[model samples]
Target chain A: MSGAKPKLTTSAMIASLAAEGHRTSGAPFGHALVALAQTRLDIVGMTADLAKYTDLHVFAAAYPDRFYQMGMAEQLLMGAAAGMAREGLVPFVTTYAVFAARRAYDFVCLAIAEEKLDVKICCALPGLTSGYGPSHQATEDIAIFRGMPNLVIVDPCDAFDIAQAVPAIAAYKGPVYMRLLRGQVPLLLDEYDYRFELGRAKLLRDGADVLVISSGLMTMRALEAAKRLEADRVGVAVLHTPTIKPLDEATILEHAAKPGRIVVVAENHSVNGGLGEAVAALLLRNRIAPPFHQIGLPDAFLAAGALPTLHDRYGISTTAVAERIKSWL
Target chain B: MADPSTVSRRSNVSLAQRAWRIRRNALRMAAVQGQGYIGQALGVADVLAVSYFHALRYRPEEPLWEGRDRFLLSVGHYAIALYAALIEAGIIPESELETYGTDDSRLPMSGMASYTPGMEISGGSLGQGLAIAVGVCLGLRRKNVNAFVVNLLSDGELDEGATWEAAMSAAHWRLDRLIALVDVNNQQADGPSSRVLGFEPLVAKWESFGWHAQRVDGNSIPALVAAFDAARALTEPRPRVILCDTRMACGVDFLERREKTHFLRVEPDEWDAALAALGEMPA
Candidate 1:
């Protein structure tokens, strides 16, 4: 019943751990979705009793009457959302990444994705964000959902991107599987004044020496790697793409085709069919031959660990990203 | 169609010919496709005939009307019965029935809302349609609308745990606006449901779950009309359930005689005989 911004914000914690300038994408997506619900009547929200965790509580608070609490039934949660969508209401159904990706894939496939209904499935804790071990980490989420047809997958990088992408999704007409980065997230993206477009990638920086292509939370690490590598006399340009599916082949190929430039695809997802596989497919189909390195988790289920320890263990840190780029060079 | 309460005031004799016509249409549709779940389809033809001809409040010209009582066929394989009933209801033409299951036909083997009219939900995955029907009930109830929800399910489909979860929720919420009719045809895809999952004492299960339950001979038009009329009569704080005990191939001679007619391929030679067997029989 009270609104108080804690002095110990997530951005403050990030400043203490990493540096003064870093951003998170979680809370902004929650806030933007609330603002979107004001003008868009069709936007209805539901969660599997994780309203606070997924940050959809923002929308729930504004439109309490429209929200449905499907109490931990992830499959029914998705099915109910699809049912509401079938009735011409745009339902934003939220749950953890593991449940949405693994437990309810068939329901999502048959009800929402295959039927081509307009259900916005917002999933929290993609990859190793939740170090609750294999049970919580959804490292294989992108691989599973990407193989399904007619589903738009978006992995926003920072708070600014989440805020922008939320309104974009409300405008989009088909089904979308969005990865959430919840809770007092960092604010590194406000520096670039980034904008979001579904299935369209953004070009953050342009450098012919090397192309660091990254999406989702990994884009933050890629930007840091670019800054650190600049001090070492290696010119690098970071291209931050929050949209993974219907990937920005024009921009990806544009940078990959640049003469004497090496491409490094970075993601928090697995090696197979993640952003790495998607971009690789795009390059191969276009015949844009370039030296490429995939920076992502190996083909194994990650065990439970601390969030920071997990990111480091999986080689998704800025240091590991810098090392991958150095090896390609 | 007339209001169910008003239709129930008349005797089932008025609907005898319509029930036979629905059964005849179901057999022909299956015969044209050379295959269908006609056994299950035939089993539910009487109820569908009563609902389409005399009970449900709907307009054939307006399938998506807001005031219509929603009817969802939860078991998608029994779409032959739904297609036949929809055609009889005038939501679709008799000519389009020939295109059922063909490459470009709206009437596929399973029900899809995008392809067909009057299909409230896309079904095939068992135990899915009832939950959506619950959603429809909740949606209409919230608006203070006096609409009813009816979902046709199979005994075999009860093996799905989601159906029980939805059943518990519907009864606990006292969804008087909702009703579940079980097509208890005994036989399933592999064998009898009794041998497969053993859904014995089905009426007791519904009673224990807090639903007003009853059993009726599903093949009898008069019995089906009366059972549904009884379901509509309840105004208490619990949903009602009708257990429809029926033979696998209720209306056809060849299909009913065979033990392996669950997913029968009605051969070209057997089509005319199957149609003739169901031609004049009052379902």
Candidate 2:
């Protein structure tokens, strides 16, 4: 089924790249960055040796002169980005989500966030996207970063969202932490004809019985759940909020304000402080009381497993979300 | 704002006075609070004084100037030193120094970038500042605009694995614009670093990581200035590390001799005696 747009799927984007035998996430970010480079000369890229994992090698390929390989140093990656911002040039820093969140948090906090530099800290494999287990999974990335001042967090839903969000974040003035959906991520938002906005939420579908407030690729699963719920004659609206930090409270409160509305926050992250908690806080603080069902991984560290198995095990799949909403109703 | 050429040659008098004041004010500030990191403040006073007063270019009126040299105080307990320097540098009013460690003061126990002006990075969590400093360096480099990135750390911070990771990365990228100053006061919170985690031959360790490393008598003004001057002269891609062998509480006699390294507590009577014994601030 065509999501916001039917022409492209996340897998199809990756499959096209993979079909040509390109192996790492670094290739795509780098390639797309170079494509962005032709039009934008002010664009520069830096990596903490996750260039291969984050696919920034594509940009590295096009602008070898502008690309800096900082080598396994996430702190320097952020510092360099800040330095570039100081010089009136835009810098796109790439790394694994875990390293950006856990390893180089202080640098990101000080050099970028505190200073309010226009640095793009784009990270790949956010949440359970990585099979490398708890160490690599950035389950607590949003939680740790949400409290940081002047940082805009973006958890794009699919390839189309990523493609749209990249230029969107580039145009943004302050620092940004974009949770990357790499490796031919699914294209769901385009199917709904949704447009990207930094702090706005996109209501993919309308429903009356329950509202699925989701972000990132899980919004796709929410769409699938909504379709399934439609067959059961239960209305499930999908509110896709790509920008998680400056959370679109207006959209959240509007949908959740209705009585008997079941708000299910689905995400590929841990339940603690992820989309589930963010949405709940927004509703509760705004006095928009609704029965909330937080569908996400538990508080504990998730173990290493296959992608399909991990999603099913974590209860973030379409079937699992549908079942949880059915039970909540 | 003056051109880069004129800015460097502007004046050393104010900066020199700033060094003296940073030392004097730091001691006085520590005396007011009854006890604080006087040793660190006194040790790195010259370098901090130089950076704030002369060597670095910044706008006091515009703290967020795009072309300003960045300073990250990795050893946050040394806020007294920074407060003294910032005041002398005109980043804040000298009157603010009265509220040094007080409740209402913008100055907190540790350095916070959010509250303080001219504080490039908020530091206190130990080894994290170097990493943050690296971020500033990368940011500046990406813009192709050459700006100095200086990080001041304690000798004890060498024990943190994160410091090494930042050092390795900085050296790998050949961040010549970046400079790291190790306040080798030989003391940690527990005691002298030798007793805690001995980083003996620390210069060699930095050299092994591909950095241009040097040692300086941190208390000597000429030596500190010369060391920094030489560091700025290097053209290689490697970052520079300056090992400052500073005496804990260099200007004060009593606190320098105390076994306590973290926080020093002097009796009311001894406080006056200590201040008097320290005498006039060095020129």
Candidate 3:
């Protein structure tokens, strides 16, 4: 009974991603933005009635005069963000990832990306991070926006990454689509003293048995999987690529080119357009064909359930990743 | 190099003269493409003329000056019209008009903010400009920059739900610096804008959204000038809107008589005739 785990509660459906005992940072994006805005007078925050959900309420409270509550219109939110960018204010736009990628795609494409405005589109509940099923799951957001010109995409892994990415994207000249991890984000990378660079991939752990190239929360999962796999003598190297677009090609090619390691692209997105295909294409183009594999969500609408069940079912959880890697080995 | 449009930026020229120049510039730009949103350009010429030549404060040399007033052309097809005004305002050189719609041309068929100097936002996707203007107004207020933002969207754009969303936001934010200009030319791709989806009681609808709405004949230079002036004169918390009821292919009599002028494709011989018709009022 002491060793056995408690039953997963309904709260697991919308619980924080932070594992028990591991330190969690409270709304890194919101806090970082509030700090960055103190000096950068042009930094403005905006949301489409998702302030509290996306953790923009923190910034809203800090700078009530600078925050714009655009209500439920995602198109208007993106359109307004683009407009604010044009007027020389860097707008951090927050909403559900599904809303930004699916609902207001054309607006984001034409207004922000096309114009190359300095608008930070940070959306909450990326991929299966939301257990609200297909309605909330932005499983195809990366695939949807991967082809857009002038858009630099970021998928941060933890609170540390989110905190660093806030000012980095703000300092960046053009448009950025960042998958935000809000509400007690895991401060995982801080253990490794990792710094978030805009387009560079960080190699968190070195292993000869397998190379796990991952982004977003999947990277955190990959790190955990790496630690567990180490006990089995199945060395798992985790490459944390927060920036999805302008794929840290040199770093990826360098790692994938290494022989004897089974290179697997693990992502929280669909197997379709997200980082998996991107890495596969990059490897193929470079002719660095190692024993390749991918651990990702299926190209289908996920069922409504607890996120832990969903992650395990979809084969993106830490245990699932470790099990899949062992099977591949 | 010696274009009157460039020189006309100086106040020596009358608004009527400036409007004439804008129409000519648009026609010339259309001549390059052979087919475009020419009817829209022609109809919206008066508004563009007033905006660039009178209402907006912008430096020809520095189009992105932070303090300058902004003009958002929501309808990208009306790039010919806005480009014409830009050329007249000396923002874009007259030589660029010759390359309109070409592969390497800065003056593409649609208005792109990145390509053009004074083009504030890339507008082709309708119903987005008003929202962008609302943002710009909010930004200006935040920076405490005393500059007005004019969003010129077509009547067809009113059919978009985002426009109404922006309308509500502008009022909610108390963005007095925002001015929405609706070019109610009553022509859309499918059919007439009114019949396509009638935004009837248009002024009343805008008023309901807490805007200072005004309906005026858009082709009349005097009417447009007065509306623009009245819009600026008000320092109220409510955003201002000028619903300009305009005629498609205005000034070009023979083209105006044609039913489908949404994307007017003038006959090869009629380009000169249209230009000539633009010169003299239909009498």
Residue-wise lDDT of candidate 1 within A1-329, one digit each (tens)? 77875333122111212334553344676789888888887778888888988888888888888887777777777776776776678889899988999988877887788788899999888876775668887898999998899899999886777888898987999999999887867667778856788877777876667888998888888888888888877888788878888788898887788888888889989998799988888899999878888999889978665555556668888787887787778
> What would the per-residue lDDT of candidate 2 be over residues A281-322, giving only the tens digit for each residue?
788788887777888878878867555556667888778888
Write one digit per residue (lDDT tens) for candidate 2, span B108-203.
778987779877666777887777676667657666658788899988889987788888878766789888989898778888789999898888
Give the Å error, residue B160, model 2: 2.2
Q: Is the docking of candidate 3 incorrect, acceptable, medium or high quality?
A: medium
Stretches of candidate 3 off by over 4 Å are A1-9, B1-12, B280-283
Winner by DockQ: 3
lDDT per residue for candidate 3 within B152-214, as digits (tens), equals 998889899999999999989888888889998888888887688988999899999999999
Q: Is candidate 1 or candidate 2 better by DockQ?
A: 1
Docking quality (DockQ) for each candidate: 0.43, 0.42, 0.78
lDDT of 2 at B44: 76
Best by TM-score: 3
In model 3, residue pairs whose N, Cα or C atoms come closer than 3 Å (at least 3 residues apart or on different chains), thus clashing, are none
After TM-score superposition, the amount by which residue A37's alpha carbon in candidate 3 deviates from its true location, in angstroms, is 2.2
In model 1, the clashing pairs are A23-A186, A23-A187, A23-A188, A24-A185, A24-A186, A24-A187, A26-A181, A133-A304
